[model samples]
Target: MLPNTLAQEMPRALQHLLAREEQTDMTTLPRRSFLKLAGAGGLALGLYPSLASAQAPAAAGLKPFEQPTAFVQIAANGDVTVTINRLEFGQGVQTALPMILAEELDADWAKVRSKHGSNNPAYADPLFGMHLTGGSTAIKHSYTQYRELGARARAMLLTAAAARWNVDVKTLRTQAGWVLGSGGRKASYGELAEAAMSQPVPEKVTLKNPKDFRIIGKPTTRLDAKAKSSGRQNFGIDVQLPGQLTAVIARPPVFGAKIASLEDGAARAVPGVKTVLRVPLDRGAEGVAVVAEGYWQAKLGRDALKLQWDTSGVEKVDSEKQLAQYRELAGQAGPRHFDADMAPLANAPHTLEAEFVFPYLAHAPMEPLNCTVQIGDNGAELWVGSQMPGLDGMAAARVLGFKPEQIKVNVQTAGGGFGRRAIATSDYVVEACTIAKATRAAGFNVPVRTLWSREDDIKGGYYRPMHLHRARIGFNAQGQVLAWDHTLVGQSIISGTFFEGMMVKNGIDATAIEGMREPYPLPMRLTVHHPKQNVPVLWWRSVGSTHTAYVMETLIDEIARATKQDPVAYRMKLIGDKHPRHRAALQLAVEKSSYGKKALPQGRAWGVAVHESFSTVVAYVVEASVKEGKPVLHRVTAGVHCNLAVNPRTVEAQIQGAALMGLATCLPGAAITLKDGEVQQSNFGDYAVPRITDMPQITVHVVPSADAPTGMGEPGLPPLAPAFANAIARLTGKTPRELPFKLA
Candidate 1:
């Protein structure tokens, strides 16, 4: 039996598709359409021919795939099917994972097809012991397992073919999905697949060395590029179901506030309006949903509904007030210490002090939060673009009052995640399920889809907490950095959240204190954390490094200025001579950008910053000019230490994209506030994102290393902010401490 949620919708979804097919000519249907229709027709056809009998069973007592699985199946034809366990959210895992398997299998690349694996614990990353994809672990975690599985499959096939020819297995070699022996006698994998399945599974398999890698390091185009470019990709917004109703939610203006009461007469009177129900915005829930026939109609109805909210707790909280509190907190001595304090500044010949401020920011991904849910008496199913599929399933179970096994989650490709989709805080999925349950209870088998407008996404849930850092550095007469003391004040990102148990301890959130503690060769260094309350903060892309990098790199520039030393050489000295990766990245960035060569056209100046995150060291040099005081970045040159790059082209794309994103955060972008607790900026027009016109000419150079691949998504974000700020300092001869620097 199918789970109750899918069981309830199965008949309806099939009937809808059948009805549509009848209106069109089946002979003229496209191949993709036929595949979609066949899959939806409940044929139970396995993508893997070997798994034809292993159909996903009814609610049996099987454990989920918690460790990643690699399964290859060869059909009667030459088609080779590879199953990938990770969710593909535009991080290129779909292509990258398959490349590893194909390289080891020696399979014909042209005949290979990919399929998404079932949700089972056996497919989880061995490091995390759960089926989750985040933290830049996708490629590194899957590297060995994929290769081993492919090698094992190839060995089995070669053994089967060799036995038929009565030859030693060592004498047979496989290439292009074929097994070959002496005199060029060969058979395709498809011909030997059945016999291969009968062979004993190998207890040990040998993987190919990097020196023999044929396709692993090559720059192959993304497999989904054509589909995405043609608008054929199926994101959550594109999911449609029979009798599915569209929903829009009415959220509280302030975070953690409640809806006291609502008058829904006007909303109910709107065309296509169905129902307006109150839902909880609790731990695993969002606000009440207004369900209707279409998204626009539901939005109209929600806007027409008059609702009163209880804002007692958050009414007095505003951005300005939060800034004031953070500044005060930064000045006080705190109990939590990340590093030992430097001995008092007695007898120091030179001292430098500065304060830097970072404002609260939102992720604001291109596609807002949304979910399509169908609920029944025994279970619920959700379609969403989620990073953490396991968490989504758990949240669905909690919302529906069912066991985790009763919920099914179908992951979709996201327009942009940037860490937002990984978070369950918004609780949009739970809210959609709740609406579906309520609608079903009313005798209407309504499939509900909830859509959050861009405005709703901006003001909802946690934000990157505003931070303030105050630092005092004492230098000796020889300009050798003697002592450093830094205090960071910000809302703890991990406290009072689901991630608190894993990343926070003793009132200190590691993300909030990221770059404050350093391993550099400083004599006396003290890192202090002063935590703040009343602000809801979550991890944004680079987390605390976003603000921490800005503070640390800018301070280094100040020290270099005070000592009258060249900025690049000064940083090279302070970073010590032993760390080769940092030294290599810094040196490459300087050489590639021609640092200190010809002083960027007249009034323009150049600034440099470097940081290490997710095991990748990146250095950035930015050239900017102050126009009437506002800093205009003209060009950016960056060097990345990705070690051995799986795809240099993709790495370059990520670096360039992250550089532009960080530049936006430094100047033209900010989430604003108002006295009445209303968010002043809503939608793209008000909450400005960097456009093509705003982008600078970016050049990214990848430093090759044979080491494991590091993260490409977030490491590029930390350097751009500080690099721009330092350039501004050089241009105006004044250190700008606050973010979104206003020239006028």
Candidate 2:
């Protein structure tokens, strides 16, 4: 984390973030309203539901938020339902969180079920106190909370069973959803459901030890696997209600650019078109929403509309021009992150000077962003795949002139989000509410489902900030770093958002300087320049690690090559046991991938990279080769040290998917370039994401640990590109500096 100057000047809640930020712990990501209470520390179990509402019964000996009825429900036929607090965006929380709870509850694996949670304060993250699913905190922060939730429920069930058997509560034990009492008396959890819920919820309960865990750490299939495979799973895009109108907006060409004129006669002429209304869009822009009976009609209506001619007010960002400006900024003296002595670099025996360019990247999730809003007389309900529903609910209230409680947000499953759906602006959700408000005001008493097509999401959404990194390193022939001069230039992803107060300070956004000079200590002087860009930007998957990992790893590999030492050994010696997780991960990957011990197939070479993000360490050793003038990754072996593997299957899938996305950056068409302030690539054909053919065979291995879980959703991503790049460097004598490799 970069040094901050505004620590004492910021709010008390924000001041509390400095200690966590200094440790680079992504798990403690905070929200505005939540930070104040979270700063006070010791959030009770299950969020103290009574504090959220007076409806929570003041039952005998059952404290607030300990209501077993909130999270668990047992049916008459012996089925258990567990409510997940976070949105399931294909990261497998739908199964993983349930597994954690079920493990403690001793529920039958075959009869367990999972359902999505809402914007209910009871479902807020136990640590951060917000309705969040990003930052890979779903399992990391809630692992123990879910366990306690299950244990508490089990305790109540035992108490009820004991009462029926006329035995002491301590004499009763649970086994596979059945409570066993003295004299061989037993009752299924479903059989005692009502009486059990009436019993007092426990204030605290002992959790199962790792040795006693029957379900956690096992490679369990997802609860939604069958539905997803059978195409029966319903995402937000698939939601429908009676008389629901579909709306698609015709946004301005550039960010914050407004419409000067409007001609919607042709749009209204489209069949099934209901109405066309000009509405306020994100970033102070205006858009015309074309409402129709269905998506097809709305698409036609949106495409039919024509009228535009106001561009003189906004900045027209060209990719080349922006790159030139970034390069200029990279060379200037700026705010320092690590200001280490650089005198040794002037006369080092060995040195490496390199520059890397990462283009603006769009989060092209399989299911493009969409939201459904049903506006009633005094209240509105939203059904969307929101990572931050609390913030979105507040934003919707503002758009509809309703109180926060009046707006109820039902979290929905998403096909994929990467990081787009977790925007601070609540851009998509607010836009949908605005559309529904417009429809209701125009005598069209109907709910509205606003869908962004692939084109719309790709061309008009926030992108990962394009970045430029320049590094000059000096080291001995033996590979001991003497000095490293590094500079990063990019637009701050959190600069204009609420996160800026916590994530940025002293004119330097720590997000831009993360993943530098650690794991392997090196004397370094790191500086950053955050230029204000017209394009909207947000965190993409692994965030700063996306580019930072690539730069740090490949450059380290280059040093090993120069020093004529084994890359693995060089890393191990530099590592020197300070970070056991990093060492364990790298060593595991080296052994599993058979680095230096096994022969490669013909032209294939071994590529190695290790990185820690979101407190989880993932090391990748790749088999790579250049084929037909393009880089090809044949196979990848990953070693992960996430502390615990709730579901090894989910861990494996996340790695495979993230590695594929990482490989996408190396493809020829991966860059989201702009010319004259307009996105050049609109759809999948031009904007290259890895297709099925591009997928490499990947195998995942986790370093067995009994420690608390870190984060797995994003750690698998950062190390992939660098491992692939290291192999490419070994294949081609030249190092590739820019993304979407342009070969000469």
Candidate 3:
């Protein structure tokens, strides 16, 4: 069942999405139509074999590098299929990416559909040289790659049409999937695909100018919106195969704990229970896998098992103790991120010292972690919603003792990931492969689907590390910051991962300090401390910006209030004229929201905040009031500057969704904590996520620009909480130092 957090879409939006998904029975188009063309002498673009090549070499093979020229396909029936190289996960890449390709192809928009690409080498991120999607880099990195692909395909079709009509290539123009030559010669891309595939691949192609773009910056609707709403879209969790068995694991209560004793009598007695096996789990924790005919039985079998765990030598983290230690660490600066003299603090006329605490956050994607693995003599096949398919596939090959080329990974659509689906260790994928390998060793050759129940998912680790921030600022009555000193303490997400070498330097993880004092050029000293902890940690949405932006923006607002200056005007002064994008975004929000001029309802006040993450700037003007001793956010108006919106509709949706998730951060029970090393919160019942009623009235507006687009998935989130807090502060006359506001 989908979480209420995700199902809170407006009635009309839900109707549209459900209607589309209901009409479509499956996620993928009928490959038969294109496969039937295999024996024909026609071109079949972007085709991947259903299985690993039978001719795979005994050792590592060049076959591992081969991929279908496989992004755009035109069928003889004039259907255009565009392949998206990254996971969708509700970010709209499935729609925006296809729009980019179809725009360059000049294909008829109505004839275009999209397909999710797997771990094939051709689908690797163009800039990163890996099959991964995170850091909001999908569109930023692939914008040109897809455009070039479409242009090349379009160029080939134009050449074919020109040859067919015996006209100069320059004299031919393409529009609406048709190549028109001089003297009124015209042919559909489908009719020319075969001949075009045989033409010499163009070494260079001219891209369409921004002025000529018809689809790039348009307010296009999402292609998969309907399917997702209708429940016809098959996310990774919805996959079912014949003879497939569901497997659930009974994990240790403590991280890195080993099983001392286990009793499987009750578990094996459960109806539909097939077999039980011991499996190697991630982080050196041992677990028992219960395989059954269905998920419910597997879950029941897991519940029935009695296992004794040995937690010796494992750190039992208590949240209260950790916070106390972090607070002590913050008082004493350790490593410096910025070198600035704070000598003026001693003599400054006015000063403020504040401490902020942020708890660990669960990504809690709508669909819990799931992976299906099937091992065969020739090769192994895996189906998953993998953000890094190549990485996961390689990990599977290593675990199964097969060559990389012998493993085939089929990437599936995901409900939502934030940052959970992409991991350097490929933790969940490896766990599934381990279970499958154990099942095979136990004499079961059937497909094994590893599923995580909502409890297992919430208790599972890899959360946003808890953070503490201490800031000391000295400013005059004019709001000019004379001195600033900041200290941050937290666990480093990249410390033990493969990316540690590149992402961590000088005792600082790059992601850990991304949104620190920037758009405002203030002379300040910033220091950090990274403590090793037993809990696993990963990036959550906006990464460090999640906490940093809140600290920076809220403190800035405090400075404005201290100086008796309008928050918006003070922010503009600090932003200066250097960052036009930030300035423009803030100004636009101010104007659209009528920040100073609009009359608010009695007891309501306006709040403002602006932040930039992943190169995208967003500003929010919000209205809030205190109702019955609780903060009530009534409405929000957002101004986004992602340069050119690939699909305005998608940008709007991302902001609205991200804002809600941001609001979730300020709601009661919106945190993950540990007691005796075990996760205390284990579902929506205890771990709060915003319901439909919690959502504020939102209006999203984008600054029109012809520049290249930036990321939208994360930028909208960083400003929401601070804007709400700023409004609440106006009424309470007190600063909010902790999350889930404790009003007095």
Q: Report model 1's TM-score to 2 decimal places.
A: 0.87
**Model 1 lDDT vs. the true structure?**
0.71
**Candidate 3 lDDT over residue span 1-744, tens digit each:** 222321221111001111112221112212442343222311122333333333212123212222214677789978999888899899999999989988889999989999988877677665444577777778876787778778878888888888888878999899999998766778998999878766655546688998998888889988987987887889888889889999999999988899999999999999999999888888998999999999999989989999999999699999999999998888885888887999999999999999999999999988999999999998899999998887788778778888667788889998888889888678888999998988888888989999998888899999999999999999999999999999999999878765554457789887788778868998889999999999999989988888988999999999999999999999999999988989999989999999889789999999899998887899999999988998888999999999889899999999999999999999889999999999999999999999999999999999999877877878899899999999998989987888867777
- The lDDT for every candidate, in the order shown, is 0.71, 0.84, 0.83
Question: lDDT of candidate 3?
Answer: 0.83
lDDT of 2 by residue, 38-109 (tens): 333312122322333223233565422245567888898789999888899999999999999999999998
Where's the lowest-lDDT run of ten residues in candidate 3? 10-19
lDDT, residue 153, candidate 3: 82
TM-score, per-candidate, Cα-based: 0.87, 0.94, 0.91
Candidate 1: residue 416 lDDT (0-100): 78
Per-residue lDDT tens digits of candidate 1, residues 1-744?
233322222211011111122221111223444354233321111211122234222223222221112367788887887777677766777777778888888888877877665334445553333445665667765676677667877888898899999999999999988999999799998999888866765646788888788877788787777898898878888889999999888887766678777799999999998888887764423366788889989999998988888887554467777778777777776656546446646657899888877877888888888888888677777888877665666667666788666666777777777777765343676677777777777667867888889988877756777777788888865567767777777777656554444346566676676655343676544445545444455668777778878887888888888788888888888788766788898888888999888556998889899987666788998898888656888988998887777777677777887898898786765655544566666778877788887799999988867676766777898889889888888878776788877655
Model 1 misses residue 58 by how many Å?
Answer: 22
Best by TM-score: 2
Which ranges of candidate 1 are over 4 A from the true structure?
A: 1-81, 113-118, 163-166, 193-203, 283-286, 313-315, 376-378, 424-426, 523-534, 672-676
Ranking by lDDT: 2, 3, 1
Best by lDDT: 2
Better of 1 and 3 by TM-score: 3
